[model samples]
Target: MTTKANFPAAAGSVVVPYGHVVGNEKWRGSEIAQRLQGKIKLIFEDGLGLVDFHLSNRICILYISEADLVAGDDFKRRLVRFRNANSLGGIVIVERTQISDQYFIAVQKLVVLELGMVLLPVANQGEASQLITQLVREQSKDHNSNPFLRKQCSQLLEASVFRTVQQIPGVGKTKALLLLQQFGSIHRLCNASVKELELVVGQTVAQQIHTFLCS
Candidate 1:
């Protein structure tokens, strides 16, 4: 069993190699660990402090069982302690069976809003195993592969900006394009004088643009 003293408490210091998960030794025979078999590589380590699983060097998961909710307050303290002790991103996996449904809202507020950690509820260990597998896969994927992380096309960005400029009252596509060509960007256009804007658009449209931006 690996003791707490064997490793640093700072989760960022722990290096989780690709395509693997480090689980707490206590979970070695647990349903979650068992179900995770053949899905991804799982390695057990002792005294991982308050974390139940390490998905990566920067992210660790804390499992809260139905019994933990029933028992009350103890799990809250553990979460707070983990937050205080480590700089890693903590994902709270909660078992939300019918018996534990009542505590969901309160747990959500504390784990997500108060503690600023992610809280994901699962029906059981099997569900948790599946979720963990997906999370691991997502973490392993290249940043560019995620649509949200990918660089947007320049043409799409220019069209979007053109549309935004057109949304101003009294401004149409011709004036919007003229304004963009003069100013180069929304920020410069917003900061432009009514007189400067009149160079591209008329006095009325320039005042309208100024009012829309400033007011």
Candidate 2:
């Protein structure tokens, strides 16, 4: 069976796992590996070899395991080695069994070293495949959206309202926006009496704003 690693790199590189293979569970492994291979270029090997291969490829590693996972000093050492050897994009460790806190901590440290994140309790190969596909789709959408443009617009809109509200001592951004929306203009909002403001900004805030403006 082809592994997820066999699938083409989604961006520059990605690492997928063959998962766990208990005795006589070769079929499961083969099946997952085949499905992955059909999608990308894959490398199939034991856990130790998988680690080594990730270092060599300089790609993100997706580790699939069902056995008890313990990330001890040895694993940390390997992570350090991998980091030094390759431009480690990310590390996603998928566990078949319930993970222990100790194991999670150890893996988390490895991720920190590699600048990666851990994905927990993946359940099975199918689930892992689905997760990867969804991630790719989301990433693609973000790429298409021109993050800088979106961020700039959001920042400008926030700053405009924030600065405007700050001029009115007791009116915060929310109250200010509520007043503006309800009255259709800041000038109209200022013209409103406390009783009129209360309908939109609530009684407590309206009182505060009236006191500030009257002062």
Which regions of candidate 1 deviate over 4 angstroms?
1-10, 143-215
Candidate 2 per-residue lDDT, tens place, 1-215, comes to 33322433323343333222111113235444445444443454333332422312233444545543554355555555555555444345455455544365335423431233333346766665554433333333554443532343244334443344444656667776777678764445556799998897778888876765455
Candidate 2's TM-score reads: 0.37
RMSD from true fold, candidate 2: 15.8
lDDT of 1 by residue, 1-215 (tens): 22232344445676565677888888887889888888888887766778888887777789999999999799999999988878776778899999998887677656643465666779999999998988787656763343321222234345545655676788889888898898886668868999998788889988997877776
Task: Report how far off residue 177 is in candidate 2 (Å).
Answer: 27
Q: Rate the local accuracy (lDDT) of all candidates.
A: 0.75, 0.46
RMSD of 1: 12.3
Using Cα atoms with residue i matched to residue i, what is each candidate's TM-score against the true structure? 0.63, 0.37
Which ten-residue region of model 2 has the weakest summed lDDT?
Answer: 18-27
